[model samples]
Target: MADQEETHTNGSGDNQDSPATAKKSGRTSLLDSGEDFEVLDDVDEDVDDDLPPLEDAGGHKKKSSGEEESAQAEGANVTELSAPQEEWLDVLGNGLLKKKVLEPGSGPDSKPQRGQNVTVRLRSSLADGTVVEEEPNLSFTLGDGDVIQALDLTVQLMETGEKALVETDAKYAYGALGSVTPAVPPDTALTLELELLSASDAPDLELMSPAERIQLASQKRERGNVYYQRGDYAFAVNSYSIALQITEASSKVDISPQEEEELLDVKVKCLNNMAAAQLKLDHYDAALRSCVSVLAHQPDNIKALFRKGKVLALQGEYAEAIRILKRALKLEPSSKTIHAELSKLVKKHSEQKGAEQAMYKKMLGNPADSSAQKRQAKTSWGVSWKWLFGATAVAIGGVALSVVIAARN
Candidate 1:
């Protein structure tokens, strides 16, 4: 899918070779801004050695075997004083993910909720112990598509101060297209060490600054793009929907003109991308609504127009589809994608019309066939009438002859 952007006037002081210019020059880049783009090429060798021993909520550190024995001697339950279990628990029961708790956390009754902000320290490595990603402290909204599916699912199962070693299948992590930043190979599994630092309710959108909302919304859109690339259309749709919600909420708050424009641009992009994802899921009506919403704000948005046309065609509204596609083509006369879509829609429209005509002919008898049958029936009736008249004449003639003979006698 092509990335959509609004045309912005460069001020005299602005850099002529801005990142925005570079992004606009290509159709492949899903992100509108370069501020949050990340690459994880550098590996911290001391990452393993730097972290202190895992500790629970009450500052109780994980104990060694001897320490465990000492704690048991002090009347602590032997089971509770024992080291974290080495036995791996299957998290999903599908063999895709397996977890072994290294340090059990306190507060068994509390865990991160959906829509809450979660912070964790993460270290991911390949099966051979080559670290691909290491973050001292990473924070994201739980269940917001901020992280990989595996991390999201794994963290929700954790409590504050919990430490676990998780084995992840590629499908739950990066799928086939692995990270370019981390230099991970395609379809490679990884070992993750995660420590749930904390979880708290997400900040209200109204309470956040306009810039914060824009940044968060953009992050969500980028996440959605990742899901889209992985062919996870349902997840992609959810991410985009969340982005749209953030932008819509941001619009209500009093904001500067520049912020408003930026928010609108992001909103348009999210709506367009969401429509594309929804279309992939065969959600024709929802896709149509998304496209329509984009057009209402940005009438010349070629992507939105093209997608709307596609959804309409899928719904068998060929005439409207053609009109929408033609408009899109007109707006971007040089866009090969728009031209190709329009051509396809036209072909489909013609085929659909032909099919409809054939179906009507079957439902209502064909005019030519009807006329021929009528003529055949008319000719048959004429022959029968002529035969009846001839028989009557013969009978009448016989009767008259008999009467004449009687008079002569």
Candidate 2:
């Protein structure tokens, strides 16, 4: 579900009026102003032909004996930790909260691993018994950000049929900014009851054909979109990245040119979306890189250009921002979103220019005063040095005359 776009008047979010905002107040965003993506013409999809083959679920193909021995040695270097005998465990390594298993079940083997979808029945509320959210069934891949970080960590530590109450501070639950729905207000502590229904491994990527990979990538893209709409930028980034990884991997597999084009298109969309998430996280450099990648394939991509311009604007490179945004406006003349953003940049540029002029004037002051001060300092230094030299010469002459008079006597 896409989060309904809302105008924020509280001045407590990203400064830019883009569709998305960062977790903190007064940052910039790369999310486009609610527009469809501009499709690009086909490009060469075999860009990464030199990369190594991805490992299958079983394992990588056999290499030379030396390489195999080396891999074995590296594996030997790894030491696995014994399962925790202590009842309480901290999942994220930070001391946010301690998870003590309410009822222990079948151990590690029964637990779900990363990339496996886990289904759970969730009931959440404030410490004061105010219900925030409840769902009879909710499913999310482990290690994915579909659920809150703490909950994701907690469930992975439990087995099927196990139920646990995870207590977390407001920081881990909602942080400073609340959810899009305002159901979980900012900085509100939460108690969640999670009943693990089942866990199953997702389809193996390496075993899948090119078509299957494309389908999976699309699914992940949709999931990412849902997360983006909810204003969960971090989760959204994760989903997009997974989708991108799948698309790239699909491109590597033996596929026809048409299939490659479709995968590349999906890849481009993922990059664009991931850029938006990066913007909301205040990751300007990453967002710019994504835009750069998109533009490499599609120069006329309005979203890419607009996002790039936005990133430049946030970085205070108003001149470049204006140039890029103007180019985008040419591509989309009637787009109020682009037009509005361009106006903002132009206004920002004017303000910046005025500020620079004021600062220069303040430093230089009246031209006459500046020149007078410079001349006065120069004159004083020059006169002082001359007088010191003259005094030394006179003293030397006096000493020479005294010596001559003593010799004559």
Candidate 3:
């Protein structure tokens, strides 16, 4: 949920019914004017994908292998951490309560592994204790069925421009999986180090301002970003498409190939976005072809793998679905969402195998689907003739016991 923003009344307290006051409060206040949060730079996570972040079920956030414990130790005033780090941040604190900006993400929502995501790193640890695991960026699109409940709650604390590190229990983090250590069960209490990177969708604003040529492109990207957030993949794709063309035209800006990597990522996201939109619209073949195209460029892309796997599943290619999803699992072994999906597919495949065997048995016996003759054959479920008789009470009828009772009388 988006937080309600409060605007400070200017001194002299005259009737301040001006749009300037509304604009001054940032997008947070403007949201009350019914502005779309998706169009803004900061994408909110949905409320429903309330599962653990990793597959380990170890009651802990999966610590990324890329990071290690920094020399920074012990909690300081949320404002007084470090001046240099502070420039990379904006903070809000009222004594023990505070909000700090963490990291920001790209315009397109892609796999957690591939590109840099917009993240709001937040911290609320005990003054004496240390944070056990590093926090991932949450500046991506959050919504129903996308992120864990704890993160959802954390993001909800800030209005569009507000930021804070809310001290919530393990009940919030991992939804009961408290610690990153698999040994610990869920619901254990823990602290978070949260930070908000930016409040609006102007992530590229700093760059856009310097180059006047890219202003229109930035605007188009922002609009595409909004469409992406609202689940309007088609419009989102169109918005991104226009932005891409503008970028191509604005090659005058001196950007290294490494910088170009980020732009390419945005393009991949657009194509993936288009394919996903197509997938949701049930254009299975088109989705599959689009995913294949994305994979041609980024063979290791987990998002394309997932999309391809879904397309295969829709095409009744269970084996292919299982294969593609397994590859994705290798890329992010700790991802619980992927593991859950794989589990579902595995169970489905197992059931399908059993049904196929049962069908074969019925064909050999020349029996109908509901034939009792086939039931007794034990096609995996083991519903044998004897078991069926026992279930129906067909054996040892009550008459025998009644006859014995009559004899005793």
RMSD of each: 10.9, 19.4, 26.4
The lDDT of each candidate is 0.74, 0.71, 0.50
lDDT tens digits by residue: candidate 1, 1-409: 2543432211110011112233555224331111111212333323332243355225766799998888678876435454433667666677988777788775554567778999999999999999999998999988777787788877877768989999999877776777776678999998999999988999889888899999998878777766665567777778888998999883445799999999888898788777866776778999899988988998887777877888888888889988988887788788676677778778887887899999898889787789999999999999999999999999999999999999999
Better of 1 and 2 by lDDT: 1
Ordered list by lDDT, greatest first? 1, 2, 3
Q: Which stretches of candidate 1 lie over 4 Å from their true place?
A: 4-85, 250-253, 358-365, 369-409
Error of 1 at 94 (Å): 2.7
- Stretches of candidate 3 above 4 Å error? 1-221, 244-256, 366-409
Best by lDDT: 1
Please write out the lDDT profile of model 3 over residues 285-354, one tens digit for every residue. Answer: 9778878877998998776787788789778899989999999999979766567778888899899999
Q: lDDT of candidate 1?
A: 0.74
| Candidate achieving the largest TM-score | 1
Indicate whether candidate 1 or candidate 3 has the larger TM-score.
1
Q: What local lDDT score does residue 276 receive in model 2, on the 0 to 100 scale?
A: 73
Better of 2 and 3 by TM-score: 2
